[model samples]
Target: MPVYHQPRKRIILLIITALALLLIARLSYLQLVEKKYSRLADANAVFKKIIYPGRGLILDRHNRSILGNDILYDLMVTPSAVRNVDTAYLCRILQIDKTEFNSRIADAVRKNGKVRPSVFAGLLPAAVHSRLQEGMYLLQPGFELVPRPVRSYPYRAAANILGYIGEISPGMLKMERYADYQSGDYIGLAGLEKTYERVLMGQRGIQYIVKDNLNRPQGSLENGAYDTAAIAGKNLQLSLDIELQVLGEQLMHNKTGSIVAIDPATGGVLAMVSGPSFDPNLLTGTERTKNISQLLADSSRPFLNRGIQATYQPGSAMKPLTALAALDEGVITPAFGYPCRGGYFSCGRRIGCLHSDAGHADNLRLAMSHSCNAYFLHLYRLMVDSDKWGGVKKGHARWREYMASFGLGHRLGVDIPGEHPGIVADTAALNREYHGAWNSCSELYVGMGQGKVAVTPMQMANAMCIIANRGYYYTPHFVDHIDHADDTLLRRFREKHVVAHVSDTAYHSVVYGMEDVVAHGTGKGARIDGIAVCGKTGTAQNRGRVNGVVTDLKDHSVFVAFAPRDNPRIAIAVIVENAGTGALFAVPIANLMMEKYLRDSIPLAKRPMVERMMK
Candidate 1:
């Protein structure tokens, strides 16, 4: 019988031994080497809590806090742990009706199963939180108070620039870009907050605490060996001068336009004001949803950052680029001039000029100072019809390249978002619009910034910077430097950008003309006593439809200027929509901004003018 025994029996025994060894190894791994399964098993007796770090502070150039942190508390509830709770007493403590309380409980249970925690009431004030905390034990082991840092604006002037934070949306929670965020996390919604969200939103930490069988937290597991400490956000030091910002906002009150000022040296935004802007605080705390809804519903669109979002025809503000183009191409010179009668007549159309019949705009200085429409129109035609390029299409393409280099007809790559690249009509576009029969003369309106070219106040201000810096500019930005941040975030703005390949002499000639503008030309209203202000006034033609019929409207007042011609500190662009003229409206606002910034005070003599403009 021993000799006849089959080898199959021995093989089966070996296989059974191997299976037992594998099972023991796996069990050993589950209990010791790998902790995931054990953690799952212990979940009933362990609580994982999220620790939110403090957001960075936003300070102005003067070291004054524009936005600071405030302590806020949230009431968290564990649905499954709730028992023997007084419904009416809890509702009274939270200041919610019975129906609302029930609805919240239902929502919590629906969102995060019965065993998990959910927000019962969030962003509670210090007073309300203290009162509720004193009576928290009355609600049993279900509710706990969690503290968080909330945004608080002390100045409250830069609503559009500082931006606001809001709770993460369902869409945001699922996106890979916002993977770090949970359903209850708050994120920057707009403006600077949105731009520097990563820097402002610090890393969140987690703590694992031991709990009893009854689902009550006892102490930290293993003395907090698995706990992660929260890292604080990096603080931002902005280039904005709060005093100047307040002044600009005040000057723009009751108006329907925008003002953008920048430090040409560093491309730092000094003051940016968009009229009809609501308070930044309105978008903070618990009332954000309701406030945002109302703001969105409003017709004026206060949330619109007109400085970068709104595009205008640019009027004579664009003429400086035209002059630069002609000078750079050698089609015209600082010495070139054009004679004008009442208006310019070409291609069977008459384009009116404010500087018509004034004198021979014999040089770029006179042409730009007077904002001679005929002069620029002639220069534009010469630029696009030059024999060097052989055809208007080729010449216009060259012109578009120059505009792109000037940061026009495209986004300036500002730090914030929602910027629109203004329309710069291309050759194909021109052909499509004109049935392939267009020439330089056919698009003469483009010369005066009226046809297809558009610009934002931010672009206009940067263009002025190009002139101020003499053929080069730094990409405009608001933050001068960020504390504890690497240069990668600000390196692009620090790099110099050149435009049109124009000579320094050409830029100097343009500067001389702008100076004359403030001294004796259309921009006389922007003159400061001791400071040499260089400026260009523009009146953009506007049209709108009223009652389903197209109608002509008042011109948009536009002005671009910089002070102290030698070493320019500030460059500004002002656009007053539908106002009479740049000198009448935009000039004064610019003057006040420059004066306040330069001297730290508006002269007593300028008080009356300020009052009149305020009225």
Candidate 2:
């Protein structure tokens, strides 16, 4: 107790002095030592403008520019700076009413603070921009005309392949991935544009500028010392052949269907055409919103990318896969034969056959050549009921595995978006549908590519690539390469995927049969001179409502083919909805595509067929 009381008073005084000194130091640093806070306080007189880099161009296989940029202008405004301006004259120049102008200004102020610039009118055409620029001086410090880049489709074909871009939405701006984007920034809306958006959208640079008291931008601060240069987006080289794509589109015009062509050696997509398609130009410029409304309201669904989005029963076009599965499982040999008697009368139901001649399907080759429904039905039954699998479920499971390996009954993992994984019923699903009462005959219609089986046109084309390659195929993709880009984006497409380790004997037998189908059977309509075309025809049965009742409608015509029989270059798949037989419409289209791609032009002899199909 000697000196404790006296030391307590000194300790309290020392603590108080330390606190006062700390507060004084902070105040001195803020008010006299630092200038950053002063600059921030005067931020209303500073402008940070964005310098948007031009988007990369899209080129075809032949180095032709399919998509390029065009010069456009955006009318940006700062609400707080808008004074002594003639609102009526500005509205007339922008072709807007006074109410709309006021609303736009209010929106701009809400998005960006009253002091910052926001887009009032965007993507204006050159003609309109020129007219606006002539009178922009009257608007002065409040408004500025800034150059913006917009996509222009020179070819006007492949609208579904080359998608459009639109301004970023409020929701998108909130997403973590799009944090770098501003409210008025453009984004890819669909097709290739959407798929390769990161590669196509260039980086934006920011430049902080000094401004006068009136909010007019002077030169950059510190001679652009803090500015970061924008990097232009990498250009993409597509595997598509614009000529072939145009031809496919022309052939499919006025029809409801799709055509997909793939390069056998590389799995590169050469052409993809979905019918009822609109010109790509329709989705560009100032008319985009109105055209989109009309497209959405149309019943034909021009927005649907049928090649990758539409799935339907593949019919006998799937016969080769069924045969390969059976042969791979050792359930059938190359000489496996099933004589047709007008129908497959096994399992109590009469599944009809395409032909009833005694020797039509006496062997696998003749069976495939004739597209004999009885033969494939028997093969499917045998594969799913074989002693090797022990039960129907096990055999069906094994068969489904084989189909999946061939990229059937699933999404082929194409580069494009909106790809649907086509349906393939598993044992569990079959159990659910038939209450565990299913058998080989319970779903025998699947043997002939019917009954719950579906495939996208892209998958159909890739399957043909598998057959053409004899063992393996790369994933079907549109972009062949990206300029000034890393290989990380293309590593997946470069990997070869094997369907199975089936023997050369099995593939040879199937290829021979496919060739015979075109040379001596139902696929004769697809035969090309000097080029051995291997093809299969299919008529997929479908149902529709008629007068408030479900009824049988015209079958969908389908065809799959590959040319040269040895060094195949092209594989094609065609589907025409509500058409007669595959040989009637689909086969001719396939033949024309193959000839055009392989021989560089359709021969004079095939011109009649082309004209007929165009009708």
Candidate 3:
């Protein structure tokens, strides 16, 4: 159309032609000269085998190995690659029948399609693996022997605490949290294994290996240029003394209960045992499925960590906290005493005392020594019915608040999973349960640690730590620190949590009574010869609703203690189910465990006692 337009159009065409030529040249160079790039075509030539790192170790306080890592073999199969193979010889080498072999092949095809490799058989026996490995060439591209890492328990103790690992489930594969995981990946299933999984599961690596014509792996492809190094997981150092754990397990044999010990200063758990436990190794090898099924069928519930999962009434063992609450509420003084005529009447209900002697309930310290039920019941009444709070409801609410500060009716933030927070009834809940017409006398059983209030053994041991530390405690934990890592992951446990402040005299009064209990009173069975132990014994009611009516079974024996009195090193809780009294089984076992840790040995005279308790 115009002369200026012609010039502009020519210039645009030139620029476009030059750009097209440059792109072509660049492509030619990349195809013909650039050899530095990764050879994607070589992917079929070089197999990318996954190199699994050994999981992190679980170690005791002394750095001794608690769990062992053993390498096991699995037979991986590609159903599509199994063409023209001798089925009889293959099954014979794998020590399986034709039916079982066919079943596995069909299952593999269903799970992973025909091309992808899936485990045909897992945790192979050594004899079977050796035979299959030798005859593997005849089996051709169908099968490969892959090594897998498995756990072993060296101590054969703390089965429920160490836990186990298993294959990733289909449900887990769909979750965004496990997006990186594949179907065959093994994951920690329970206990410490489950809690510290991410840290313990080391990074996976890749290796490139070239195969010969016969289909056997040769050396690394291209001198391992494309390989990545696998990193072994970081080690976790626990606060547990393995010896102490073993002893607790031994003493708890033939019984159904738990023993929990904690270092009072740091809140680190020293030992935790759930009784009737199976050997942890039973869940490790080829027998895992069968052993797990058998363990699941046991009525005693060997898998349950009773220390943190099961709740029970603290019974008379709760009197110390009751005394502290009363003193803090100004309902009772340290010097206050109660009069007892073998028992006391409240709301026309008779509450029995541990002792029926004169002067046993004359002073607060003596009341505690004798576990005088009437004295603590009187205190619970006064605190809840005080005129300062102006009503029963408000006073009880304040009391509940104090218990919360003491770490009751709540989870203590233990590193392990499935901790029970226990039941600590608030006034509103009580009001509804009682139809809004209840008084302080209606729940007096709570004063001596019964009725609706309950606690796990772990909580009871932590409570002992509060009294031992005088007012504050650290959150009880099993792993003290991760070896070679910064303390950032464990900062929360290092914090000091101070319960509501009562006067120092109040703590002193409670401690005095507990000490006297071991010195000459009801809990003399808990006394260690050279160490001064402050302890409280409990005979907790195990009740049930049978056909809508109340029924009481044999009581649970419980004992909570901290030793060496002045600077307590360890605080412990022991419970024996269906035991008659705290003095019968609970107290003696706690004392022996204390001696083992503190004194390092039972004396010649105490050896008989240790043997008797072990039985």
Best-fitting candidate, measured by lDDT? 2
* Predictions in order: lDDT: 0.87, 0.89, 0.88
Clashing pairs in model 2, backbone N/Cα/C closer than 3 A: none
* TM-score winner: 2
TM-score of 3: 0.91
Candidate 2 residue-wise lDDT at 524: 94
Better of 1 and 3 by lDDT: 3
Model 1 residue-pair collision total: 0
Q: Clashes in each model (backbone N, CA, C under 3 Å)?
A: 0, 0, 0
Q: Find the number of clashing residue pairs for candidate 2.
A: 0
Q: lDDT tens digits, residues 1-615, model 2?
A: 668788998899999999999999999999999987776656776687888888999999999999999878888898888998877778887789989998999999889878788999887877888888888878876888888888888888999999899999999999999988888889998988999999999999788888887777788888999888877788999999998998898888889999999998998999999998898888878888999999999999999999999998999999998898888888889988876887888878787877877888888999999888988988999999999778999999988898899897777778889999999889989999999998888887888899878999999999999999998999999999999988898889999998788778889989999999999988998888788999999999878899999999999999999988999999999999999899889998998898888878888987888788777
Q: TM-score each candidate.
A: 0.93, 0.94, 0.91
What's the C-alpha lDDT at position 228 in model 2? 84
Q: What is the lDDT of residue 370 in candidate 2?
A: 86
Question: Could you tell me how far off, in angstroms, the CA of residue 598 lies in candidate 3 after the best superposition?
Answer: 0.5
